[model samples]
Target: MPAHLPHGSRASAACLSPVPWVWPVPGCLSQGAISFQFARPAPPWPAMPPQAQPADAGRRVMLMSLTGLVLGCAVPLSGKRQSQSAWLRPPGAVPEEQFLARCVGCGACLSVCPTGALQPILSSSRLDALFSPQLVPRLGPCAPDCTACGGACFSGAIARFAVEHKPRLRIGVAVIDQARCLPWAEGQRCVVCVDACPPQCGAIQLRPIAPGQFRPVIEPSRCPGCGIREYRCPLPGQAAIRVVP
Candidate 1:
């Protein structure tokens, strides 16, 4: 027997001597080259260190702090006393302060609006105004003849009246913005609002301002202030003819 070679040692393939310790290394040698290679399997990956686990304490603290801040802010806002909003009330509605006390969030007026002009007041400075009915003229004009909203209100907030007897339903008055009105500012012949007014009510009329020029004048006494003119105004942003509470 040939002398034993130490581990990882190699003997030439050409060597005829009996070599009992030859390690094969693919392509390490030519057909007659002599070489040896020994490779131990990479040590198993080191066990995950304790530091590898996530430190979620900071995240939990941040979430808790954010939640606390929201609640803290909300508590003060909700606790503060608030008064009724200065928005226009539905037709036949009582005075503002009294209306707030009498009105319930029943959406009765909203359901009976013939023109769908009545909408629930969803947000206001006062929490009590959340569900109050207000006319959204932009959605639809308040019909002069429709008394459905007043008739449906049983809470006495909105007083009911007969159709023949015109209800003094002055929710708000229309104000003209001379700078935006076509005839007043641009010298254009725009009679949209004047034509839209109810003939019987004669809420608006063209008054001669100069020899040839005329400006529309609103008569508060006869004007129902129904906001039909606001819906009919041609200008953008705030209407040239706007209904104000």
Candidate 2:
């Protein structure tokens, strides 16, 4: 340098200069210098033409939409199948498919049940059936004269019908387990189920099986599946009679 430069003048000049510079390596002062080239700002990179979308972009979008639609439809169908065999619906309830479609999962039916037999299905494998009303015989029996549930249902899931029609409505069928029934299993004189049968529905009848002994027999045609027999059964742990859908 012919004259001493101001402090940082070299760095400042390096920033302004267009020429390449030679800088000394800090620890290799006697060895050599490192050369750095100042590359001309690459002719301001040509504005890349906006890339065209893939030819199948629209197709891909449409396929995704269709897949979503199919999944949406499949979920309800799968739910219906899973819930088909789950619970016994209340009296006057429509067919399973129609009932599921019409039911809003409102607790109207459960609230109006006099016997507390109509309980809300709190949990189910299928989300669609949740909160819907189901007749739980163990909790209580469906009263034969009650039409409250059907009247309470604003949705047509439970059809509105007269109280007299309750006896004719086959919500489900009652089946007696011979092995568990007191008369059949233990040879005891038990007419409790027969006596508990709805007055209007003489569905359970006493049949003389042996000397001075009788067993309860269910006549499916006359049985409205009111579940009174099961509810009133004297046996402990799982009623000898059960109503099935």
Alpha-carbon RMSD of each model:
9.3, 9.2
Candidate 1 local lDDT, 60-146, one digit each (tens): 999999997787556536765434336767777788767876888799888888888888888765656678888877777888788
Which ranges of candidate 2 are over 4 A from the true structure? 1-73, 79-85
lDDT of 2 at 184: 88
Q: After superposition, how far is residue 123 of candidate 1 from its true place, in Å?
A: 1.6
Candidate 1 residue 130 Cα shift, in angstroms, is 0.9
**Taking the tens digit of each residue's C-alpha lDDT, what string does model 2 give over 45-161?**
786899997789889899999997787567777653533445788888888877877899889888888889988888765556678888889889998778898899998999999
- Best model number under TM-score: 2
Q: Candidate 2 at 57: error in angstroms?
A: 31
Best by lDDT: 2
User: Worst lDDT window (10 residues) for model 2?
Assistant: 16-25
Candidates' TM-scores? 0.64, 0.68
